[model samples]
Target: MKLFVFDLDFTIWNAGGTWCDSTHPPFAWKEGKLKDQENRWIYLYPEVKEILSELKAEGHMIAIASRTNAPTIAKQLLHMFEIDHFFDAREIYPGSKLTHFDRIMKELKVAKNDIVFFDDEYRNVEDIRSIGIESVLVTNGLTKDLVKPYLTRTIARDLPQSEAC
Candidate 1:
């Protein structure tokens, strides 16, 4: 089976320039702290969720490799947007995504050639490619219009049966 991995911050949603924007130690909320945390949500690009749903139907396993440290972000994603339920794994840290990717592939026993990764940063994409993994860069992040071609390619290559539909 193919493994699809994506970067969380800018690639998935615009968090105002950094992945830790919604958390403490960087920018703490002054009111309803816990509730505020619960209220916060990153807007998902329109096609992203639909494409992911389609990928799931094709037997592709999804995972996330990001630079987030707090586990609450994951919990919030599960409770608020239900995103956590979509991914088989959510790996987060401050360093390279390669670390997370390595772990996920290892744990899942997926080969590098069977995986594709997405990120907005060229550095991240290049690094991932260095490890012999295919990757795409989201120049405009995840706007619906901006990412259609990429979704098309993914659909064509991963789920060819859905290509005509």
Candidate 2:
């Protein structure tokens, strides 16, 4: 019954060691690897698919919110990764993560209290948390272990921010 939001780029996948906007387009999936035109591999972090599937199987909503300048490229990568079916909503654009959440809330009709977000950027985590959404700051990558506790909860409320976290 919760809306699980995720940021692209470093949170879900790394686009050739850079943001999706910087990677050359016309990306192709070749030999089980997804790469841009320049042959730079755009890869999802390990455990991403497992956790996404786990959320979907449990009937929890899933979405993507990214500030990448290349929304089209990001979508392409998502599809190329064969994980596009996992998302219920997507707000991929260049702007504050707050804007993305606002649109997602309006579209999905979900309250901020029901949304648990994950993002690699500290600023984005702070932005979503300011609105009373529980957001996890993803540093290494997204993993099932990272989101397990939140999944078991019914309403994941906001937490007080700390410098150490």
Minimal lDDT window, size 10, model 2: 154-163
lDDT per residue, candidate 2, 21-66, as tens digits? Answer: 9999898888988878899998999899989987887789999999
Residue 47 deviation, candidate 1, in Å? 1.5
What is the C-alpha local distance difference test score of each model? 0.68, 0.87
TM-score, model 2 to reference: 0.89
Stretches > 4 Å off in candidate 2: 153-165
Residue 88 in model 1: lDDT: 87
Residue 49 in candidate 2, Cα distance off native in Å: 1.1
Winning model by lDDT: 2
Which numbered prediction scores highest in TM-score against the true structure? 2
